[model samples]
Target chain A: MQAKKLKYKEYLEKYKNCPTSDFIEVERDAFRWTGTDVSLEDFIPVNIKRKPPARILDDSDKMCMAYGLSMFDTLNNALKKYFKLYKKQRIHQQEHFKQDKGTKIAMINLTKNDGIADLPNKNNFGHFTFHEYKETNLVGKISDLYSVFKSNGDFNI
Target chain B: METLIFNSERKLKTENFARIGDLSYFEGPLLSLFEDLTNGNFYFFDWVDRDQDYNRWIIYRVLPKHLLNFLNRKISHLDLFRQRPEKSVYFTDIDFENKGYFYYSAYEIESFPKNYFPNEDSYFDPEDCNSIDRIKSIIFNSFARQKSENEYSKVYHIHNLKTKTNYCNQPIGRRSKRTTSVNKLFKAIKFEDLKNSPSFDYYSKEIKLYPDLRNPVQANIKEDENKYS
Candidate 1:
């Protein structure tokens, strides 16, 4: 019923510092005010070689590393993929939202196709979703997003 | 366990990930990364057969505490840690940047793209492999091969937030959007601090930090399961 306490002196000398230690760390990718926060390793811990899971705080609830979305390249890559498929489709994106339960779910205008296919607004026009992440069943996907505006109340869009 | 001595004598900690923990609880309250009692992996799932009692979730094993604090300092004042392989890792006394700016979603001091570190390829084609199984295998292998070292860690991208879309090869900040992307944010962090600081504030991590991995239920390990098994 009791776990073992970690002895610090054991691996202190082996800490890969410099470039290795200098690498930025943070919460998982899925953590969100609107959605879930994902870890470097999906779940199989042994798979986190170079990623080395982020550090936990004193309380263990707070994230040590930081989070930033790679929008430019992401959008660029998405557009490139869309173009490679359609060849001549104009692309566009508009963010929309609604309050449900308590979180905000921003719905992107997917005017043409799922963007995975191709058409107008096809550059990187895939749908955007927000949701919470699960830990046991290996379930991760779109759900909802958080909004500055109150949910189920006065909204601008 | 002379793990360090053994590693120096002969490296055993392969780049593959190690098991941090498991998921037996799921009642639902959006768990924060460092919360005392939250799920390890932060994703959502539903049973193909709802009545079949099958649900899949993710679990994250929290790494050493000092690692987390170090990462926080790096990202919060990202400009400081924005060095290539040529720089040294040390804390500085330079005033940290705290300009309040919300780029992509959260409020970040600086936006990305200004300091984007381009990888060989930004997007990964699932079709690169002959079949879906091959793609999954590629993902599994890479995940297994990745190093826990911080340097290589930069190229890897995984999220705990709500966005389910797979980022693939695209590093953060490849876009010119507000900032918040990975590449740009890390690029913008104030590396100058480490280069020029009077007080070694960030350097003394071990002395100043309380290495507690029991972070309630929040987020974020290295490898070494095979040999032990």
Candidate 2:
């Protein structure tokens, strides 16, 4: 087993200080390293310039003018709601993954073996099958599967 | 636009100004501000005009409500743009300690006449003077309303970024260094240096940028549907 320590502190700082553009780069890197194939659009919407969505509140208070609310208050409220929604979504995803424990454990075990030929059978893995593994490298795929299985515990095989 | 037009009547082309295109891309990133606000952290914003290397520091207080409507529907996530009167429409720049800072209020800036002293305007033109006076009233009344609604509001705590000796709010140091966050905002921008460029830089704090909304996938259906209906 690889003793992989997540760069929580580094990534957290990047998340905090990096603007959406540079943040997307970091995001892409993180996804690549973690075997997350999420489209960049899914995480952050882009503009006409194909630039990532994120803005700096300037001295003009442009945001306040457009929306007719204090930039401070609007951002304050929006952020609270966004985080609340984000937290709720995360929990919902976690709960969903938990419900399919049998499938998850089987997938994790099957993924531990290398190559499509090595995978046991379709009945054991269900929808998260060999096709899903193609997008990620064998090592990253196994690590992702292992993390999920490890965090939630191995289900009855 | 307000930053450049300081008591000037000359026509300023879009080329004269640096634009910070659609700021809606920032809504997601600036969400972090909410956490900072709740934790009692006072915020001060700095605007840097990349072309001229100019900087404006802003410190502001939250606005007082003009009229509290109990029956009004609470704003939904997608319905952020629905306008309402008596809301906090601008940020007033205040001089806390004898320091003069250009405070840009959104409403005041928006109210500025599209043409200050149009060529058509002559001292003999009484109608033009009335139009100008109307513009003044709009700017004045906003300030007047703020003054009248004093007791209902609170002063925002401001942090001075400049040294006490340095009064003029200007760009810091030579060759402006981009902060990590600022750099990220511009990551995907492809710049072409054109002496006579046809496209002027478009500036807005809330325009949804990136992924080019023109693409079919990025088109916001709700906004389009509502507009057509």
Candidate 3:
């Protein structure tokens, strides 16, 4: 029994580096959603593995940490840029402090279903496809978008 | 809120107060067969394709901190509630036939030698079976009253340490006709929500029942002996 389980454990390692390729293909008039037909392609398999929550931190906690780290980096870079632009400004001045801290904004996703991919489907024509339909509300706050660099502006559609 | 897997028909056993159910999930036949082949590592539950003598609904019970870490470790995906388990329980239509014995693993396997699924049964100890009377007390807070068909018993929640905040009402995964964004399965419910929801109450302990649930025909003898019996 031990030997067999060991074999399975070895086998599972193959799935560890599961491929994360972009959609496989998009076919013309192959996928249907809400009365619209579209072609779709490329389906990346998300190999979900079970892990105890007590042993690992939750996703939300990790997301919050990422947000905080990015914000810190952003503040650091903004201060560096301000110092470079105004080299003659004294370190103690109120204007320098104001310049170091730039105005920033943040947007929170009110919809809880975040990071979902299009549904995978098989067409009658023997082709694989992915389908997507989205509706969400984004609530914005006059806070920070934490980053040491400029905002990417790569907004999710 | 935490996620739970239960046989819906088991919930109806409130009348008998004899046996409780084991936690079960569907797996591929090969994997299931492998587990069964192991030294009684897993107790066999019903095959998903059982005949529909009765509908054995495999419903997800979303509660805060009710599930064990061992069971939680088996949940590989967040979208489990959206997918139907393979081989749903089918029942025979005849009313008088005896079905079979229920068996399941009550213990969780934490660390194991590599190369196999990370689980071990608490053994085939029938004595470890749960008591319906205790479950009824936990659910309805009453000892012996039978639960009416439509009268939903107060669902019970265990305090899962993983969920400090409940998001059970929030939309999870995708939306469907029978499921609303707010009412979707796997959604977390806040502690306040768990406290306030009309459907559930909290329980603090576990109870065990001996022997297995089987037929013991006791006639009501209300009308006739030979005719009714």
Candidate 4:
């Protein structure tokens, strides 16, 4: 039998060295308590719970996103449903931002005294600083409903 | 009882999950054949006597598949339906990813006789006609009587998803007098209040005699266990 040499590209192309996959990053506002997104991945609803500070002067305060910390009891139970689906990976995360320019997600915190009117300062890259709110009738808010995901990071529930 | 056909569609927009169950709704040779296979298992009740029942048969199962399809090997739709039965039917798969939802489909066809269907006026029994919650009480009184003296692990779970209440408790084996008495102590309201009411039928023949049991062996009912739930 005559031996014929095979092209190097043919062997290399056929024998692919598989590369490791990357984690599927999930971004949520975490403020609206979007339990369904967490649920879609089999995490329990109780896990994504939120426990706002003793006195949240408005809806924006209770609505800030959570990064798997300080979840309410019921919310945590619901979050476990997702953690179970994703197997052992922690998928809960949020992008730290200062004002209205930040993407709307599941759990978001809005404790700014001036609201959107006080935004546009690019250097507001720290935690929220709430002074006494002089506005009246601006109470807190929370609801249980389906969330709609539009863009890569923007979410509403 | 009637033949509950699978709608064979996936993306069901309905708010409920339709499951396949008992075949006893259909009667005659077809039902008898299935009963022979399962050895008289109650779940095999099928299209033997269509004239017998009507109400429960009218409503059908929700499709787990969006649309049932097949290559037109033959001209007729029914032939294609039976040949490619699985494709003509669908099961819960892929789309559920990211959504924490699960699907339930029963292997048996429903055997609820049309005659067994409840009448608005009479309920199932004549005596308790005035009870306001007769419909509620009747459905709650369902039971999974032991197919055989030795057969365990058989359960009949009935829930009124509409009311969001699961009225029936499981494992309907014969209880000792002592066990019955103990259960009576803690129950806030007695089960008798619901059990004695009409509307619910325990899948029993009003005229037939009981199955012979003293001889220590698995009975005929447990053998042919392919009835709808």
lDDT of 4 at B70: 12
Deviating ranges (above 4 Å) for candidate 2 = A7-9, A13-50, A53-157, B1-229
Flag the better candidate by DockQ, 1 or 4.
1
For candidate 4, write residues A1-157 as lDDT tens digits: 4332211223223323311122111222222223332332221111122211111111211221111122222333224322221221111111111111122123333333312211111221111211112341112323343333345634322
lDDT of each: 0.22, 0.22, 0.22, 0.22
Q: Which candidate is the best by DockQ?
A: 2
**Residues A1-157, model 2: lDDT tens digits:** 6532222223223333322221110110011111133222221111111221112333232222111101111222323322232222223323322331111211122232221211222321111112111233333323222122334554212
| DockQ values, each candidate | 0.02, 0.03, 0.01, 0.01
lDDT for each residue of candidate 4 in B104-183, tens digit (9 for 90 to 100): 22222233333322122211121111222432222122222233322111211111211213322422342222232422
Looking at model 3, residue A135 earns an lDDT score of 26
Model 4 DockQ (Cα-based): 0.01
Candidate 1 global TM-score:
0.15
Q: How does residue B189 of candidate 3 score in lDDT?
A: 47
Q: After superposition, which runs of candidate 4 have C-alpha atoms over 4 Å from their true positions?
A: A1-32, A35-75, A85-157, B1-87, B90-229
TM-score of each: 0.15, 0.21, 0.16, 0.16
Error of 3 at B212 (Å): 13
Cα-based lDDT at residue B21, candidate 2 = 22
Off by over 4 Å in 3: A1-157, B1-100, B103-171, B174-189, B196-229
Which order, best to worst by TM-score? 2, 3, 4, 1
